[model samples]
Target chain A: MKNLNEISTRLEIAKKKIKKNQIKDNGTNAASLGKALKISTELVASVVVGSTIGFLLDNWFDTKPLLTICFFILGVVAGILNVIRSAKKMHKINKYRKR
Target chain B: MSLNPMHQFEVYRLGPEINLGSINLSFTNASLFMTISASVILFFLFIGTKKKSLIPSKIQLVSEMSYSFVAKMINDTAGSSAKPFFPFIFTLFMFVLFCNMVGMLPYSFTVTSHIIVTFVLASIVFVGVTIIGFIKHGLKYLELFVPKGVPVILLPLIVIIEIISYLSRPVSLSVRLFANMMAGHTMLKVFGGFVISLGLLGGWLPLGFSVALTGLEILVAFLQAYVFAILTCIYLNDALNLHH
Candidate 1:
């Protein structure tokens, strides 16, 4: 019974070690270039989307720059928020992997 | 050799043109390469699964590895509830991976480098996920745009920002893959041009750089495909789970 418990604990430790290695691999394997590309595109895409909607609405309402300006600002804010959200997620994953 | 790097991306008709009224649906190099990539994937997978021995063959191992890779990705990101989507995510990953890999060959057209192809792919994922969300949660799906706690007065602004962020998904998804592929290929071509123009003596530096860039480009190609598939899984997770 003592031998069985020792073996089981060893197995548990081995499994945990493997899990830690896997998490570390995942954290570092994603190239920084890819992350940069993903983040930059996310920011630009949000801005583009916001401005497009604003521009279309302005055309419909004949407000010219009003909606366009409003949405452009909104888009920038959204883009920053998007960047922050993704950065936080990445940070969380890294933190978990570190542990 | 053509000095113009952009010339590689030209889409000329490959055979007799097929015009549907105003629309011209002629087969082009892009179509050819896409077909090649698809057939290559089909052939590889066919061979991979043909023999079921106790010990796996190399091709079988490769196919199995890829299958498990995608399976694990979905399982991790979306959980077991997303098991039904395994085939879809697998196919998307394999197709994109094969296309990107095939494009790495000299004189081959990079299909994913084009905005239209990536855009269509992103749009499909976006639309499908939205439909799935609606089917699964009905009116509750709208709650995705609303946060848990916020002042009532500021809610509208927050909602608009959330909506804009949501709408940006497809655009970002497509742009990320397309831009990476395009930029990498263009850089490789530019370096190749530099190697030629610089001649034997000066060419060595650019040639070395080109070799390294090729290695990096191959990595980028694989990374972009993985990113594309993983993003799809993440979006699918959002739809299925409805978690903010």
Candidate 2:
């Protein structure tokens, strides 16, 4: 029936309006996903990169724990690499908004 | 016992391949089932609301609520002007929800539990949203990378990192759903196997565990769907607003 179609259309419109409202925060969630991924990747990268560096340093210095500590610190650096990058991007986004 | 818990993830070839000249049309069993499930639910909803009455019934109320819920999510995440996208968004939500819900049935395939399935869905969402961003802002959409309020020295490094992180969204989103659903279901199946094998004594404990896990899996089914929808809305927002 036309009335049924009509109701469906109106319902559709109402639905659209509601979706539009909820979607405004969707950017935040997407960014959150991005951050989560970056953090995870960075964590893995850090452990691998750090431990490798540590092992290499151990080979260089002939010391066990020293390279381990040093590489762990290096891993932290890589992790920070992701964090800072995301933060700066956020910053630019915020700054661009005011202008 | 199937040695490969993940043997269920295989893609099956189907139909006596239909040919449109060079293009072959073959659908997988997974695709077929998903479409069937979606159709069943879609017809159910369409029939439920066939009667146009001022005072709504419970089914109608539920139908209306789902509409509102999805609509609100899109509107809030993607902005009001993004209204044209409602049907697609609605379809996405319903299909996902149906797949997840269907997964709750005994001995049924959890279609979304496979990484390929989840990844395909996530990739579609990612590509759709990325295309929207390009359409809305052209090349300027890249501006999403440079965020505000950093000291002058650190800007360049930040942008590169942000871009890398941004690009990783589809994989992360897909993986989260795939991993959670797959892991939970595998553990459930394993425990369930234990329940059958252990007879009365050991079986009782696993039986209880299976019950608890089933309840949790149901919650997870809903949550994963919500997360997917919510993330889709966010991506839509970026396209509509370009947010940076």
Model 1 chain B scores worst on lDDT over the 10 consecutive residues at B48-57
Residues B115-197 of candidate 1 have per-residue lDDT tens digits of 99999999999999999999999999999999988999999999999999999999999999898899999999999999989
The most accurate candidate by lDDT is 1
Best model number under DockQ? 1
lDDT of 2 by residue, B171-193 (tens): 66677677767888888888877
Q: What's the interface RMS deviation of candidate 1? A: 1.1
Measured over all alpha carbons after superposition, the RMSD of each candidate to the real structure, in angstroms, is: 4.9, 9.6
Those runs of model 2 whose alpha carbons end farther than 4 Å from true positions after fitting are: A1-99, B2-4, B7-26, B149-153
User: In candidate 2, what are the lDDT values of residues A39-58, reduced to their tens digit?
Assistant: 46444544455566678779
Top candidate on TM-score is 1
Give the per-residue Cα lDDT of candidate 1 at B203.
98
